[model samples]
Target: MAQWLDAKVTKRIDWNDHLFSLRFQCADFPDYTPGQFTKVGIEQDNGVVSRPYSLVSHPQDKELEIMAVPVEDGVLSPKLHELQENDDLKVMAPATGFLVLNEVPDSDNIWLIGTGTGIGPFLSILADSEIWLRYKNVILVYAARHQNDLAYGDFIQQCQSQYASQFSYVPIVSRDKADGMLHGRIPALLQSGQIIQQAAQPLDAEQSQVMLCGNPQMIEDAMDVLKSMGLKKHLRRSPGQISQERYW
Candidate 1:
């Protein structure tokens, strides 16, 4: 069982409509993989209830941060939505999960696919300096309901500027379309050959590796599409070229 620690909300950042970023202070928090999540227990009316949220900040940071979308019917999400500076919440520690770089084989091209707020961990992994040396081309494909729904726009642009030749950022907004951004769901893009066309190279299963994180349905859809393209599911015992983390 994980031990619960009481941490204060150091800051909160609103990331457009529906999503928010929360930074919490925890002393001596253990290092965690980017795609890992933590059970954040909320202070409720009668008792405390917790919900799992993916870690948004990179593990190297001292203060921990998480990006979340509020759910109305959720037991803990609403309270979390109302949180303010100095407010305290309990988090189950230390964080844990497998959708990280260590489980993946070192490769030349790495594809990080996500929908909605699921892109948090991938943001961390891609920003980390250690992973940059091993991977030649890093491609990020993010899909959201609207263009305004996209998060971390500035940070992504920074990556593009720094690693101009090595990094590629593709943002797909289904309901809201703009000139430069893809206008559809990620799976649809993959199936319609848009992603491949933009990639400018045949997405060969043998040479490419994929990391998926998002709503369960989206995760399932991505896995199926990739598998149909000959990509295999990765496992701890016998790893392959694809890995998934269902943010649900």
Candidate 2:
């Protein structure tokens, strides 16, 4: 069980009209691994309404961050979007999730694939220096409806600077196109061999470790294509080439 801890919104990162990130300060919050998520909530007339959000800030950051996109018919996200700096809220303490790198089997290449706000955990993972130490190549694949939906370009650039020879970023826009950016859905790109081509790295079950985070359908479809390439769902009991987390 997790205890509710008091936190206050300290800042906001607005990427576009629909997507944003909230950074909140939780002085007493325990340190959590990259790729973990915490439940954030607010008081409602009936009770406390909460939703799980993947941590976007690295473990070293003073404030915890979570990316969000408002769901027109949902309960928590819309209200969360309306919150301003200093607004008090509740965060379930001792953040928990299983997508962290410790759970991953080391390999020559580590592929981090995410879509929409699902990119949050990957952001956290990329911030940690451990990633650079564990893999020879780290490829990030972010797919969104438009170029605007892609967040944190500056941070990605920083990683590229530090690991110019070891890092690759593949940005895919489905509903829009931009020069020098790959445009398509992830599963299709993988199936057609465009993703690896753009990254200049092959997706081989024997040599690649793929971590997927996104909508269930995308994960589901992408896994099928990966399986065709000899990749299998990873499990501690029987480890394989692929691991996935469903953010939506």
Candidate 3:
């Protein structure tokens, strides 16, 4: 069983009214892969209220980071949003998840598809240098309802600067297009061929491997589209083109 360790909030980033990232420091925290998730908890009068969050921080980063949108009147999130610098919480460390790169097979192109805070793990994966060397091209397709809901602009810009040739960032906004961002949902784009046109890469089972994270509905609908396009769900028993993890 994973035991809890006390952690102190180093900082909190308010990406928008609802979305935020919390950075904390914990002593003796175990190392974790880029896409893995760990449990965060708040001690209460009855017991600890806990939830799982994928790490947005790099393995070597002194602070561990996780992003989330608070749930109104919920047990944990609203309280989490209220946390400030120096506030203490609990972490169930030694992160675990299947979204890491090692699970992915060799491919000509790697597509990272995410929606909402599902973009968190992809940020950590992009920060690591190994991903750059492993694939010919890395395409990040981030989907959000509106422009303001899309966070981490600075880091995304830094990545575009660092890996200009090998990396491609695509932002999709469904509800509004104030910044003129590509308007539509992921499943719709996958079906329309517009997304592939933007990435300038073909998504095929033989040459492409796509990793999806975020909304269950988006994942389900997108998987249906990919399957119809001949891509199979990836598994340890039988590796194939599509790999996915659902984010609450």
Candidate 4:
């Protein structure tokens, strides 16, 4: 079992009206693998209420970061949104998950698929230099409702600019049409072969590794599609072609 650790709010990165990034400083923090999540608890009348949040920073960082989507009616979410500098937070557990960088084998191409806040873990893993050197090409497929809903857009752009040849950001907007960005959902792109065209290469099961993170429905759909294409699900004991971290 993990112990509750006291952490303080270090900074916040506001993505939009609904989304914000919360950074916390945990003293003598436990080491965590990329794609793991923590249970953050709030002091309530009866006891403590907690929610699971994916870590957005690698273990190397002294501080840990997690993104939050404020639900006005939610008990913990609203309180999370209201956190300010020097505010205290109680993390009731250590970061834990099977979906992480260790599952990925050395490959020529890697596909990181995410929707909404599910992109957090991928962002953290990709930023690590060790993972970057293992794969020749890193293709990130990030789909959101609108451009404004896409978090960390500027940082992603900077990463692409810095590693021009090795990185690819395929932003898909479902509700709005934007210049130089893919239109429609990722499922549609896969169905119409647009993703392949945009990728400029065939997505072969043997040559690629795909990491998926998002809602249950999206995860199911992606699993079906990738399975049909000969990709296999990976686990701790048995590694395979596809790995998933269903945040929901």
Candidate 5:
């Protein structure tokens, strides 16, 4: 059984034609970890159509935030994209996911990599100050199809400024010309060792912990590249150097 509470849309930031970020204020917000997700729904003529979205806001934030990209024919996203301030939405608690920092073991460096809306959880993780204290270095590698598709650039820049030497932000654009951003897919960057080169750090299995999120194929391809470097999937039963979450 799950509890569904009403959440009011407080703010909406449109990044591009297809991507946006939504902020919701819930009366009885569930206690959630940094990298957890909640199910959101809207009343439909036939029934309630719901989808799970990762929380982008840190636990200390007053409101919950979730980022999304509207699929052309998506059941939830199209409706979600049309949401206006003060609109009521159904939010199912308690948020759940295995992508939290506790799943990662001690390492010299932590890599947070994502594509598209998969970057949601990573944003939450970065917002929490605990990660800065826990790891020696934190790197965020965000990949999008176009330069404008990159969301939260300002926020990420703020984090880099605040963290100074300990944080790094790398943006990858696959289909557009970006003066300073990487210009290839994440898997290719990993395979070519360009990501590590850009970061000026080593990504060995023993010293690095990696988290991957987004398209399943990207995850699979990146895992293969990581495996070749001696990193294996991290599991509760068999902990390793890598963890992942797949976006539908």
Candidate 6:
């Protein structure tokens, strides 16, 4: 059985018409790793409906934060979007996920590639200072449909300022025009060697570790491109260079 605790919405930030982030205060919040997810439940006519949301805040943050793109007909998203400050929701304890840095072996560079709301976990990971200590370089490649869809710009900028020598941010806007942003999909950027050219670093199986999250199609396609470069999926028994998580 799942353990659930009552939480109160402390704050909300609406990034756009379709995307928003919510911060909830949970008295029983667990000590979760940076890339883990927690289940959020709301009572509905159907009894209770819950969904897993990756934690956007660092493990030490007093409030739990989650970024979400509201689906037109999603059972949980619509309701979640309607939530206001002080609204009550249920948060499941013992957050879990496999995207943590512990799963990745030490490497010279760490590449975080994400699309849409998939950028959530990366936010948590970057906020934690440990990643800066472990890897010599940390690069974030975020893909969104439009310029405005790029979330956490301020936070990422703060990270860049704090870890100036070691951190880099690359924003990829696929559909709309954007100044200083890569206007293409992630896989295309990888295939065309544009990302590597911009980073000025060679991403090989030996010296680079990669974590990919976002649209299932994007993940699959990006994996294909990475494989061509000799990067294989990381597994427990056969650890390799690439690790992935699918965000629905």
TM-score of 5: 0.98
**Using Cα atoms with residue i matched to residue i, what is each candidate's TM-score against the true structure?**
0.94, 0.98, 0.98, 0.93, 0.98, 0.98
Q: Each candidate: what lDDT?
A: 0.83, 0.93, 0.93, 0.83, 0.91, 0.91
lDDT of 4 by residue, 1-248 (tens): 78888889999888888889999898856888888888887767787788988889888888889998887688798999999888988885678887687767767888888989999988888778866788888889898889888888777998889888988888888899988778887766876778767866556677888888987777788788878788888765776788888776
Model 3 worst lDDT window (10 residues): 175-184
Off by over 4 Å in 3: none
Give the poorly placed runs of model 2, Cα more than 4 Å off.
none
Q: What is the C-alpha RMSD of each candidate to the true structure, in Å?
A: 1.6, 0.8, 0.9, 1.6, 0.9, 1.0
Candidate 2 lDDT score relative to the true structure? 0.93
Report the lDDT tens digits of candidate 2 across residue range 165-230. Answer: 999999999998899798889999999999999999878987899999998899999999999999
lDDT of 1 by residue, 174-206 (tens): 897898889887777888878877755445576
lDDT of candidate 3 at residue 184, scale 0 to 100:
91
Q: Across residues 194-230, which tens digit of lDDT does each residue of candidate 3 receive?
A: 8999888889998999999999999999999999999
Worst 10 residues of 6 by lDDT: 194-203
**Native-referenced Cα lDDT, model 4:** 0.83
User: What clash count goes with each model?
Assistant: 0, 0, 0, 0, 0, 0
- Per-residue lDDT tens digits for candidate 6, residues 1-248, read 45888999999999998899999999778799998888888977766698999999998899999988778888898899999999999899989999999999889999999999999999999988779999999999999999999998899899879888888888999998788788888998999998887776678998999999989999999999999999999999998999999986
**Residue 87, candidate 3: C-alpha displacement in angstroms:** 0.5
